[model samples]
Target: MAPLKQRLSMKIAFITPCNAIAGGLFVVYRHAHYLQSIGHDVRIIFADGSQGRQVTWYPNFSVPVSLLVEEAAAPTEYDAVIATWWETYYDMFHLNARTYLYFCQSDERRFYEKGLDSPALLVERTYCDPRVRVITEAKWIQRMFQNDFGVEAGYAPNGVDLSRFHPEVAPLAPRGPRVRVLVEGPGGVPFKRVDLAFRVTARVPDIEVWFVSGDGVCESHWQAARVFKKVKFEDMTPSYASCDIIVKLSTVEGVFGPPLEMFACGGTAVVSNVSGYDEYIVDGQNALVVAMDDEEGAVDALSRLVSDAGLRQRLSAAALQTARAWDWDQQTPIFAKVLAGFCERPIPMPRTARLDYLLLNRLRRLESAVSQLDPVHMALVRSRSREISASE
Candidate 1:
C-alpha cells in the first residue's frame, strides 16, 4: 500500500494536561515532532503557560495557555483536533472540527463530566458522545473500547526513543555477575507491583531491588520488605546497563515504556502478562512473561536471571534485537497512516455493543475498590481502567 500523506499546509493542534509531563506527554510530544518533521504544522497546548520550543531530541512544540481562548473558541478551522488525555478529550469534544483522541494513558473516565464515580451506569451519560475517532497505544485498549465501552477505536503503539535508548548507543561494561535491576517511572505505584521486587529480593538473597519511585522506598514497605529505592529517571539507564534483568508487574498497563528501554539498554525483562505487554514482547523469547495472579512468578523469573548469566545474556541479546525493531522511525509511519486516514474515514464502532456498559462498570468498580491506593498506584489503575473504559 502507498504511504499516506497530508497536505503541507494542514495544521494540527495537540492538547494535553500539563507541564509535569509524564509518559503520555512524552509519547504525544514525540508524535507531534514526527508530524512536524514530515512537514505538518503542529503545535501543543497545555494548561500552563508555555513549555517552550521543542528540543531536537525531545522534539515537540509547546505554546502557552494564552492561545486557547481563540483556539478553543473556534477549533473547527484546524485540520484536526487531537486530545492527548481525557481532559483534552473534553476540550476536543467541545470543538467544531474532526476530533481525534490520542488516548495514551488509561484514564478515560476523567474526560466525563462526573468521572468514574458511577458504577451502575454504562457511561457518564454526560460524556457519551461517540462521534470522535479514537486511537490508542495498544490493541488491548482498542479491544477494551470495542468490547466493553463501545467506543470506536484503533491501535497506535507507543514508540521508543531509539536514538537515545539503543543497545548500540548505550555504554557497555565488563562482564559481571552483580546484577543491577531497575523499576523505573514515578514508582510507589502498587500496580507497578514494586512490592513483588521485594518478594524477589527476599527469595533470592543475592539480588537487590533498585527503585525510581521519587519518594524513595517507603520506610515501612522497604524495612518490612527489604527493597531499595532511588528517585530519578535520568539515573535509570546506568542502572539498566548494570542490571541483567529488569522487571515490571503492573496489574494493568497501556504501553510499557521501561521494558522497551531495557531492550534498548540490552537488559532482559520479566513483565506481568498485561494487555500492553502482549503488543510488544513475546513470552520466553524477547522477555519473560508471568501471569498476573502468580505472585511468585515475578520472584522466580528474577531469581533465575540472577543465577543464570548465560540466560540473561541470551535474553538480553534477544531483547535488544526486539527493541531495535520497535524504533520510532519505523513505527511512526503506522501512526501517520492512521492519523491521515482518520481525517477522511469514519471510526470503526466497537463490536460488542454491551462493552460500553460492561467496561464503564468495570472502571467504576475498579476505581472504587482501589481508591485507598497511593497516588502512583491509583494513577496507574485509574489510567488503565480509563483506557479500557474509554476504548469501549
Candidate 2:
C-alpha cells in the first residue's frame, strides 16, 4: 500500500468589526485576498456590527453580547483568530481559538478627547490575550504605544493595489486640461480635514482638484468645485488615471491610503507630513513630500510637476516601479507569516470536499439573509455605525 499523504493542518479566521470601509478593514480585505492566494483557508468572521454578506464592508458594529455568544457558540473551530481592530478584538476574545490582535494605531490617540475609556487597555485586561500591535509608519506614534502604553509593537506598513493604479494607463474619457489633482472630501467627518482641501484649492486655482467623497458628504461641496461623488470603488483608479498629481492632507491617518493609491497610479503625490507618510514616500524621489505647515508646498509641488513634464515622466515611472514592489503579491507573504505565526498549526489545511460544500451553502444562506434588507436601510445602518464610531 502507498504511504498515506501528509494532511494539511490548520484553519485561520480573521475577525473584522462591521464592513470594509475607508480604513483598516480595507487592509483586512487585502490580507484576506492575499492569504487566500497563498493556500490558506482564510475566512472573515463579520460579527454583528457589520453587514455580514458584504465582504466589502467589514468590522461594523458589535452585536449584543448575548446574541454574539449564541451566534458564535460553536466558534468555527479555527486554529487561530486574528482580530484586525479593537471591536473585533473583543469578538475574538470571546471566540474559542488562539487569538491575536492586530492593533493598527494608538488607542489613546484614536479615542483622544472622544470620552470613551481606553479600548486597548480594556481589551488587554478583559481578554488577557496575546496581541501583536501593528503600526503603519509614524515612529513617534509607535514609540508612544511602546514606551508610554507599555505595549510592544510590530511594523508591517500597509501597501497599495498596484494593478488598479498605474501611470501608463490613461482615463477612458476626456479629463479636462489634464491638470487633475485628487482630493478626498470637502465635507463629511471633520477628521479628514476637508477644509484644508478647500483652502489649498483656493491657493492653487490653476490646478483642478478632483474630490472623492464617501456616502454621507453633501453634493454642494462638489458643486462649488470639481468633485466626483459616489464613484464606484473599483472605478476609482480612473480618478488617479486622469490626475497629474494627488494631494491629501488629513488630520489623522493610519497609513495614508490616497497618497499611496496615487503613487501607484504613477502620478506625482504631494502628501502632508503626517503620521505614516514618511514610511515610504521619500522627498525628491518617487513623490514630493510636503510639510503640514506649508500648504503652499502643495502648489509648489504641483507647479513643478506641471512645468517639468520630463520630471513628471521620471517621477511617474519611478512611482509605478515603487508601487509594483509593494503589491499584494509582495507584501502578503510577510502578512501571512505574521498571521500563521499566531496559530498553533504550522501549515494550513487543505479544504476537504465536504468543507467546500458546507462553505458554499453557508455563504449562500448568508447572502440571502443580507439581501432581505433594502439598500436604503443598509446605508442607514452603515451611516449609524460611522456616527457611533465617531462618537466613541
Best by TM-score: 1
The RMSD of every model to the true structure, in order and in angstroms, is 8.3, 10.7
Model 2 Cα lDDT, one tens digit per residue, 81-117:
6666555554554555544445454332444343333
**Candidate 1 weakest ten by summed lDDT:** 223-232
**Whole-structure CA lDDT of model 1:** 0.63
What are the runs in model 2 whose C-alpha is more than 4 Å off?
1-9, 49-52, 56-71, 103-108, 114-146, 170-172, 175-178, 219-226, 307-311, 344-392
Task: Give TM-scores for every candidate, taking all chains together and pairing residue i with residue i.
Answer: 0.73, 0.72
lDDT of 2: 0.58
**lDDT of each candidate versus the true structure:** 0.63, 0.58
- Give the C-alpha miss distance for residue 282 in model 2, angstroms: 1.1
Which numbered prediction scores highest in lDDT against the true structure?
1
Clashes of each: 15, 13
